[model samples]
Target: MRLAPLDGGEDAETKPLWQRLGWMVAIWLVSVTALGAVAYLLRLWLA
Candidate 1:
């Protein structure tokens, strides 16, 4: 016997606007942190 999953593979558009904004903010935060770490390391090595 097979059971269907809830929401059934819905499209991203179905998510509320706030949820999308949350994901964008999280990704941007991660990117900024990574860049800052890289810049700091380079400055330390070059100095």
Candidate 2:
């Protein structure tokens, strides 16, 4: 298999609009999951 050149920002800049959106969604999901877990643990400890 051939590798795409490490043209800085080229892949990111040329990605379809949805690709950027998909990344944002994935990040948000991770953030929410982490925050929820922390809050649950804190509540469990305080209670």
Highest lDDT scorer:
2
Q: Which pairs, if any, clash in model 2?
A: none
Q: What is the alpha-carbon lDDT for the whole of candidate 2?
A: 0.91
Clashes of each: 0, 0
Give the runs in model 1 whose Cα sits over 4 Å from its true position.
1-10
**Compared with the true structure, what per-residue lDDT tens digits does model 1 show for residues 1-47?**
64567445576768998998999999999999999999999999999
Model 1: clashing residue pairs?
A: none
Q: Positional deviation of 40 in candidate 1, in angstroms?
A: 0.4
lDDT per prediction? 0.89, 0.91
- lDDT agreement of model 1 with the native: 0.89
lDDT of 1 at 45: 100
